[model samples]
Target: MTIIEQYGWNTVWKDKWNGKYREHEGRDLLPGRIIGDFGSKFRVITETGETWGELAGRLRHTMTDSGEYPSVGDWVLLAVQDGGEHAVIHGVLPRSSVISRKAAGNTRDEQIVASNVDTLFLVSALNDDFNVRRMERYLIMAWNSGANPVILLTKADLCQDAELKIAEMERAAPGVPVHAVSALLGDGREALLPYIRSGQTVALTGSSGCGKSTMVNWLSGRMLQLTQDVREGDSRGRHTTTHRELFVLPEGGIIVDTPGMRELQLWEDEGGLDLAFGDISSLAAGCRYSDCSHEREEGCAVLQAVAEGVLEEKRLLNYRKTQRELLYQSSKEVKQKRKSAAAAVKAGSSRSRNSGWRKEMDEY
Candidate 1:
């Protein structure tokens, strides 16, 4: 296999390159995978070698949103430039999977975390940093990304009741695999090895100070990333990994380590909420009313399950909370789209009026 193949390049990608981008082959356009993203610049590994790359002028100008740009783990076609040292990315391949979240703050835009990921490792430290609710949010995004989600409870050594935490996570994330890993003691590596073998791409994500960087270093068998201690009071670690970057593991397989998120807002939900909360979804199916909201409604199976202790009330509340958040986000997106359309029409009218005025002046 070539160097690019080690980074999860396969015959499928080859077919895509030949079928769509064959015309560019004569112009020295090569297929490469993005390893590092530094805002405007990227580090890509092509068959020839690793090189710095920037988006082509046309690609940058035509991009409509941040998610369209090349991020870590994206496969892009590059044209060699500047004595073969620099490359210009001309096109991004259609992604098989993409992990994204709502842009921070009030913005209603999608921020693509990584693309073409096969598996998403949702890591949460077993210490005070562990929050099942946050894990539920991650699961929603993970299911939406079209990648298999696996929960990894890290820092098992720090927690006295690691088994209990693992059970809790299992209950919270049904149908998803959960494992407790202790990076300090180097335990639980065996359970994780199956997912990290040859040609598969896995991305680790969680809030800051959750042992994600430490897990990366351990999995790579080297200090590929820096590690830091969590604060004594809150158990929150400083942001050790500042950016998202892809690393090819020494043993085999690929991993993308991302900076810890302070808050993860939902971008959009395409049946992801139902998948993440499968138990609740199953219960809702039995409700007398097909569109039962499960709040103070007669014959609501979800409420009945919660009351009967079959389901945790807290879990149901979180599901409802996330459901409402997604609904609100959808409303905001519609309003934003309308606002943008109006602004665009107004600008076009102004430009036309200006052109007509100039023409009249010329006639004068």
Candidate 2:
């Protein structure tokens, strides 16, 4: 197979690259895929082979945020140097799909986990790390990213009631495939093979101790990532995979493995919440008010469903919590935009006043 084909490249991406080709004009550049990121620099795989690439100075100066930089699974335009061992990234093609999460801690920044993914495996262990609420959050992110989500419930060997856990996850994530697997025992791996076909890209993401690396190793049929044991008391494991890296599975597809996130604060839901909690959103449509808060309000279909035992109360509560978060974030973004616009207006006004004052002085 050709290099681009091996790296999950196709005509759609080729069209995007063609658009960039026109923008670059006559530059001696080639298309490369980013497989690994090293802080300010990245490791790109071009048709020629693998190479370490750094962002061009102009690209760095113009980037308004980290998202503008090349990430794992990103296809970029680059200038190969030193016999193709090193390169300079000039541009990033439009992403087909991107998986992101709010940067950890108090910051409102969005951290790009992976880009250009076709499928997202929202892996969660059947052990203590499994939380239906967290899975719901991941489903929201998966839906928002525009990739198909398949919930992977790992460590079936450890869970006595693996089927029960899978059923519970199915409830939390409606209409999405939920598979139970034991990477150690090599069970249920075949169910995932259909998603990991040639010319497609898949991403594995979840919290620590969820056996993400183990899944990677099993699927790849090699020890591509290191694994650590989880604490017996809490089942929390250290961040075995510190950085996001893309690997070519011998089986015929590409996979991006990311570090376990401690918290996945949402950046934007973009109708992801509605899809993630479609049951709640569908019921919400029957509310008396168009903007019903669904909080102890009369004629609230959502609350009525909860009361009637049709919908789980905890699920509705979590849906409300996520909705409020998205609302607050949206408001904050709008406020920021307004503030920036006001500042620009004030600055323009000040400049105009100065210009008038200078004209008057010159006239005098």
Candidate 3:
């Protein structure tokens, strides 16, 4: 099959993207897919396999400061320009799915991790860097993205014991499948082969030094990129992959490689929290109070489990922490939107009043 056939974008291109989209009275343009990026520039591949394009200044002006810009795997429209070296992106097509996070630190903007992803591989190393709490954070984001989440427990060779580590992760993740693989030795790597089938799209993401790039190289059967061992002092790896990129596996599957992130901030995914702490949710449901906070509430089933030793305190603490973080983030986003809406209303009212005065002056 051709690129369109393999990517399943042919029909999408025909029905939704073939012509200009004039939603609410806007003009139209030709369509393309954002395949990669280079600082402030984009590389969009059209449905026809022609690649390398950039966004026009006019299109950039139309973009609201907050809406997600074109990310890898996003379908976009372009006005084919004069240069054989370039084309201008006019607009971004509707996205089916996107995995995102608030850009690390105090930035109030959401960063797109990847778009239109079929599966999310949450890679975690088996070394000292592995943290169950961190895995929980990844799971919540994956659940919110509407993509299936698969846990990849990498670097089996580094760990002294594999079974114990796997069991701990499984306990935290509950129903999720956890696979242990050693990129260095290739042990247990076969378990992940079935997922690399032709036509499927997967993305690799996790903390720095989790062997995500190594796994990518292993899958491609060549040294597609460089790899670095974790620092001996802290056991954290340096950021090797600088940007998000879509790579077609020689075997069959498509995978998006992402830069290692020490920080994966959560954005607006309430359901993700529910799915991540499902056990906690189930327990909290039986609380006498309909709106129980699960903190110091009398006759709380969640607390009862903790008292009975069925639930670990650390698990409950992590659940509460994640819930609070999401809640805070949601509240912050709401406030920002409210302030923006008020400003927009004020601006629109001013524009309307100005237009009325201008009409009167013209009549006189």
Candidate 4:
């Protein structure tokens, strides 16, 4: 197979790159896929095999933030140097799907977890780390990612009520496939093979100790990633996978495994929320008011459903909470943009005044 094909490249991506980046036409630059991303450097796999790459000085200068840099699943054009030991990245192809979240901590910055994923495995072990509320949040982000999200309930060997947990996950995420798999026991892994067909790419992500690494190891049939046991007191595992890396699966596909995330803050648009909570949104259509808040509102279908035991009140409450958080973040981003614009204008005006003063003094 061709190098690009091995990295999950297809005709659609080639068309997109050629149509948008016409400048690369007839150039000697080769196309490469980024499989590993360090803070300042990247590991790209091209026709020449794997090579370390760094952004060209010009590309680095143009990048306004880390979000613009090459991510693990990005397809980029590279200028090979030093006989294939190193390369310089020139451009990045448009992404088909992206999994991102608000960066951990106070910053409102968006951190891209993975890009160009065809399917996202939303894993949650059935052990102590399982929480329906957290699963709901992950589902919202997964919907926003533009990739098919398949919920995986791992560590089924440990949980006594695996079927019960799977049912709950199905309820929390309607219309999404939920598979209960034990990586250690090799159960339910074969069912996931269809999603990992040739030329396809899947990403595995979940909370720490949720068996994401174990899933990677099991699927790949080797110790590709190290797995540490969760603490006895608290089911949290150490960050065994410190960096994101893409692996070419023996089963004829690519899989990007990311470090377990402790917190999954939403950084998404309204459409994602609507799709993630389609059940609630469908019920909202039956509300008496066109703009019903669904909280203590008269004739609110959502509240009515909750009251009648048709819908879980916790789901409705979480939906509203996410909506409020999205609204607040959107407003905050707008204000920050306006403030930056004002500062730019003031800086320009001051520079102009100083230049005029300098010219007058020279004339005198």
Candidate that scores best on TM-score: 1
- Candidate 2 — which residues are off by over 4 angstroms? 19-25, 340-364
Off by over 4 Å in 1: 24-26, 64-66, 348-364
Per-residue alpha-carbon lDDT of candidate 1 for residues 273-321, written as tens digits (9 for 90 to 100)? 9999999999999999999999999999999999999999999999999
lDDT: the better of candidates 1 and 2: 1
Lowest lDDT sum, 10 consecutive residues, model 4, at 19-28
Writing each residue's lDDT as its tens digit, candidate 3 over 1-364 gives: 7665455465655687544463313434556667676657777665456667766676564563747578888777766655435677767777777898889878788888888887899999888888998999999999998778899988888788889989989888889889998877878767777777876778889999888899889888878768987888878999989988777787678788889988889998859888888898898889999888888989899999999998888999998898888889999999999998999999999999999999999999
Candidate ranking under TM-score, highest first, comes to 1, 4, 2, 3
The candidate with the higher lDDT, 3 or 4, is 4
The worst-scoring run of ten residues by lDDT in candidate 2 lies at 18-27
| True lDDT of residue 157, candidate 2 | 93
TM-score to native of every candidate shown: 0.95, 0.93, 0.92, 0.94
Error of 3 at 326 (Å): 1.1
Task: Summarize candidate 2's per-residue lDDT along 110-151 as a digit string, tens digits.
Answer: 788999999999999888998999999999999999899999
lDDT values, one for every candidate? 0.91, 0.88, 0.81, 0.88
